[model samples]
Target chain A: MSDPTVVPWPRPVSAARPESVLTVDDILVRFQTRDASVTAVDRMTFDVRHGEFISVIGPSGCGKSTLFNVIGGLITPTSGLVTVAGEPIRGPHPAIGMVFQEESTFPWRTVLDNVAFPLEVRGVSRRVRLEKARDVVAMVGLTGFEGHYPSELSGGMRQRVSIARTLASEPKILLMDEPFAALDEQTRLLLGDKVLQIQQTLKQTTLLITHSITEAVQLSDRVVVMSYRPGRLKRIVDIDLPHPRTSEIMTSDAFGHYVAEIWGDLRDEASRGMAEAEASRGART
Target chain B: MSISRADHAPALVGAATLLGLFALLELAIRAGLVDRYVVPPPSDVVASFARIVTEEDIPHRFAQTALEGLGAAVLIALVGIPAGLLLYRHMVLRVAVQSWVAALAAAPLVLAYPLFLVIFGRSAMTIVMMGFISGVAPVTLKTLEGLSATRRVLIDVGRSLKLTPAQQFRLVLLPAAVPTIFVGLRLGLVFALINIVGLEFLINFGGLGQLINELAERYDLAGTYAAIAFVVLVSVLFFLALERTERWLRPGR
Candidate 1:
C-alpha cells in the first residue's frame, strides 16, 4: 500500500524561484463511517513556492480534492503537517483561498457584492473594497456584469466570478480544486488563458488539481502525477514550457510532449482506479 | 422573453378562469337560477360593500382584526425564527426537538383553543397566543431546513475568508437561508391568520369575526355575506403584504 518515490532532478523550472510559501508534509486523511475506516490521502507531501504554478493530475477519486481541503485547513490531516508562510496551518487559513469544483458564488448577491464578499467580511469600507473588487472583476473580464446575479450568468461566467471573489480576498496562495471541470472545453480554455494571465500579473502561488492533461500542460510550471486512492505521488514532471502561456499553446508539440509524459505515468494508475471502482460496484450489487 | 412568458402564463390563465367563474355566478344569480338566500347576488354583495364601512362601522372592526393578525405575525417571526436558529445550531437539539415541532403542525391545534381560552382568557391575547403556538413550528422547522441545507462549499468559502461564526451567519448563512425561511414564514402566516381569525369567530371577541357572528345571529344575510367578503379581503391583503415582505427579504423570489 506504500508507494514512495523521490524527485530525480529538483531544479526550478522558472529561472527565478521564490521562497516556499506553502508546504504539505506526509499528509494523511482518514474517514470513519459505520462500515469502515477509509484512507483518502496518505503520506502525501509537496511544497509550493511563491509564484509557482503546480498542477496535480490524478485519476478520478484519487483524493486530489481531499488534499486541497487539507491544504486549505478546512480538514486537518489525521497525521502529518501543513504549513503556510512558515506557520503551522491549524484551521481555515485566510492566507490561503480555495475555488471549489462546483460553483460557489452567492446566488443572492450581485457579481460586485460577491467579489467584494471577502473584503466585506474583513470589515473593509464599501467604497474602497468595491473599487478593489471592481478592478478584479475587470481583470476577470467581467466588467459589465457587476450587477448580474449568479443565476443570471452562464456556468463559465459564474466560475469567473468565483475566481474574482477569491482573488479579491488577496490570499498569498490559491488552491483551485478542479475549477474548470464543469465547463465545456472552449470556455475552459478561455478561463485557463485568463488564469495564466492573472497569475503572471499577480505572481500568487497556485496549486490546481485537475485531471485534464492538456490543462495541466498548458497552465502549470510543473505537473505532479498522483496515483489512485490512498493517493501517493507517482511522479513530478517538470514542465519546461515558458511562462505567460496561452490556451492556444495546448496545440503546440511541446505541450503535447508534456501531456504525453505525464499521461505515461498516469495510464497505469487510471486503469487500476477503473478496476477498483468496478470491483466496488460489483460488491455493492 | 420566452421564459418570462412561460412563467406568467399560469398566472394569466388562473386570473382569467377566476373572472369567468365570477361572471357565470353573477349571471346565474341575476337569472334566479340560484337562490339569493344560499348565495347573494354579485351586485347585492357589491352594494353591501358600499354601505358596510359606514353602516356597520367596519373600519374599526377591520383595524381590530388587522391589528391582531399583525400581532400574531409579529409573534410568529420574533419567536419562530430564533427558535429555528437555536434548533439548527446543534444537531442533538434538532434530533430531539424536530419531530415535536413537525407534529405540532398537524396536531389539530384548533381543538386546544379552549385550553388557551381557559389560560389566556377571552381576549385578543388568546387569539395572538394561539396563532403564535400554532404557527411558530412551521417557521422554525423551515429555518432549520434552510440552514441545514446551506451548501457546504459556501461554508468553506466563509471559512477561507476567516469569517467569525457570527460574521459567517450574517454574511453567508442568513442570505442563503432567507429564501427557504421566507417559505416557512408564509406557511406560518397562513396558520397564524387562520388561528387569529378563527379564534375571534369562536370567542366572539372582537374584529371581523365578531361582526360576522352578530350579523348571522340577526339573520341579516346580506350583511353577513358582506362581512365575510371583508374577511376574505382581509386575508387577501395579508397574503399580498407577506408576498411583498418575502420578496423584500429575498429579492427576485
Candidate 2:
C-alpha cells in the first residue's frame, strides 16, 4: 500500500457556485508565547464544497485543532481569509454549527432541553424548539432518552446530544473536532455510522478534524492531511467511496487501501511530532 | 440493606449520640467529677429549657435574630452575587481586589463592629449591617471564582452556536457556575449568622445572644447552655434550608 495507485475520487456533488461554500485562503495563525512566537497554521488554504464531507487528519499537536478553530471563527488567523458562501468569516455565524470534543451537554438540562438550547438562544419558542430538537435527537438515534440528564447518559450518548444540539440550529455547515476521540473504538465506529447517515440525509456541508484514519476514510469524501505543527497541508487524498456509508465498509479492500494510503502520508509526520514532544519535555526537565 | 437500617441509620446515629452524651454528663455531675452550678448537667439544662422558653421569652428573641439574619442573607445575595459577577466580568477588578476580599473574609470582622455601631446606631441595624458586611466578601469572592472557572470548551460551544454574550451567560455560564455559587452562598449564610449573633451579644439589645449574656451574668449556667443550644439549632435549620434550595435550583443533582 506504500504507493497505491491514486484513484481519482469522484466529487459526490458539485457546489452551486464555483468558489465553493467555505473557502480558507492562505490562512496563517500564530501564537505569541512567553518566550517566542510560534506558528500554528502556516499559510493553509482549502475550500469545502457544498454538500461535501471534508476531513482534516494529522498527528496530535499538528494544528488540526488550530485550523479547525480558524474555520469555526473561534480564533482569528494571523493573516489570510476564510469565507463561507461568499461572506467573509467575521466571527461565529448562525449558519455554521459546531460539535465540540468535550462534554458540551449542559449538566443542568435534560437531553431534550440540552438539544433545544441553541434554538432557545436564537429566541425560538418552547413548542417549536423542542419539536425540532426531538427530530435531531431521533436522527442521532436517541429518541427515548430525551428526558434524561446528561450525567445519566453514557459517554457516547452525551456526544449524541451534543451533535443533536448543533443540528437543531439548522446550520448551513457542520464543524466537528475529534468528536469521537474520547469514546471507545466500538462506540466511535457506531457513532461514526450515525454521523455518516445524518450527513447523507442532511447533505449539509461539513468539515471534520480527526487523527483517526479509518474515520476520515469511512466518513469523509476528501481528507486533507497536515504535517507536524506549524501545520501545512501535506496532501488532500480523496476517498472514492459511495454514499450512505457504514463502519462495515471498512472491511472492503478499497477502504483499507485508502486507510493505508493516509497512514503512509501520516507516519513520518506523527513520529516527528513524537520526537519534538520528547525533545521539549527533555528541555523542560 | 434492610429498609429499617437504611431509612433510620442517619436519624438514629445523631439521636443516639445526643442521648449518650447527655447520660455521660449527667453521670459525671452526679459522681462529683464536674461542677453542678458552673457546668450544668444535662438534666439541669433540660429542666431550664422550659423556663428559657416560657419565662425568658425565647421565641421573641429567636424571631429578632432570625429577622436580622434573614435581612442580611437577602442583602448578601442581592449585593454580593452581582458584585462577584462584575468582578468576574472585569479581569483587572478581579486581580486588584480578589486578595483583599479573601483577606477580609478571613478577618475577625467583629473587630470592626464599632464603626457599624457608630454609623447605624445601637439598633438591630448595627447587627444586620455587620452581618451583611461579614457575609458579602465570601459570597462575592466565591461568585467571582465560580464565574471565572467556567470551562473554556463550554464557552467555545456557546460562541460557535452564535450565542450573544448575555445569552452565553444565561444558558451556559450561569448553569455551570451554580454548584460553586451554591457552596459560596452556604459559606456566606453561615458567616452572616455568626456575625449577627455576635453583634446581638455585643449590643445587649436583642435576640438569643442577649439571653445568653444575661444568663451568664446571673450565673444561670443551665439557662446559658440552653440559650446557646438554640443558636446551634438555628444554624442547623439554615444549613438544611440552603441544602433544600441548592437541590431545587439544580434539580435531580
Taking all chains together, each candidate's TM-score versus the true structure is: 0.94, 0.94
lDDT tens per residue, model 2, B76-140: 98999899999999989889988999998999999898999899899999998999999999889
**lDDT of each residue in A1-285, candidate 2, tens digit only:** 532222233533645443488988999999999999999999888899887899999999989888888888999999999998879988887778898888888888899998998888878999999999999899999999989998899999999999999999888899999999999999999999988878877877888999999999999989999999889989999788865578999999999999999999999999999999999999999
The 10 consecutive residues of candidate 1 chain B with the worst lDDT sum are: B244-253
Highest lDDT: which candidate? 2
Model 1: which docking level applies? medium
TM-score of predicted structure 1:
0.94
Report residue A144 deviation for candidate 1 (angstroms). 0.8
Model 1 lDDT, residue B43, Cα: 70
Go through the candidates in order and give each one's C-alpha lDDT: 0.87, 0.88
Name the top DockQ candidate.
1
Question: Interface RMSDs of all predictions?
Answer: 1.4, 1.4
lDDT of 1 by residue, A1-285 (tens): 421221123444766667889988999999998999999998988888887899999999999999998898888889999989789999888888899998899988899999999888888999999999999999999999999888889999999999999999998998899999999999999999999888877877899999998998898988888999989988888898765578778778988888888888999999999999999899999
Candidate 2 is graded, for docking, as: medium
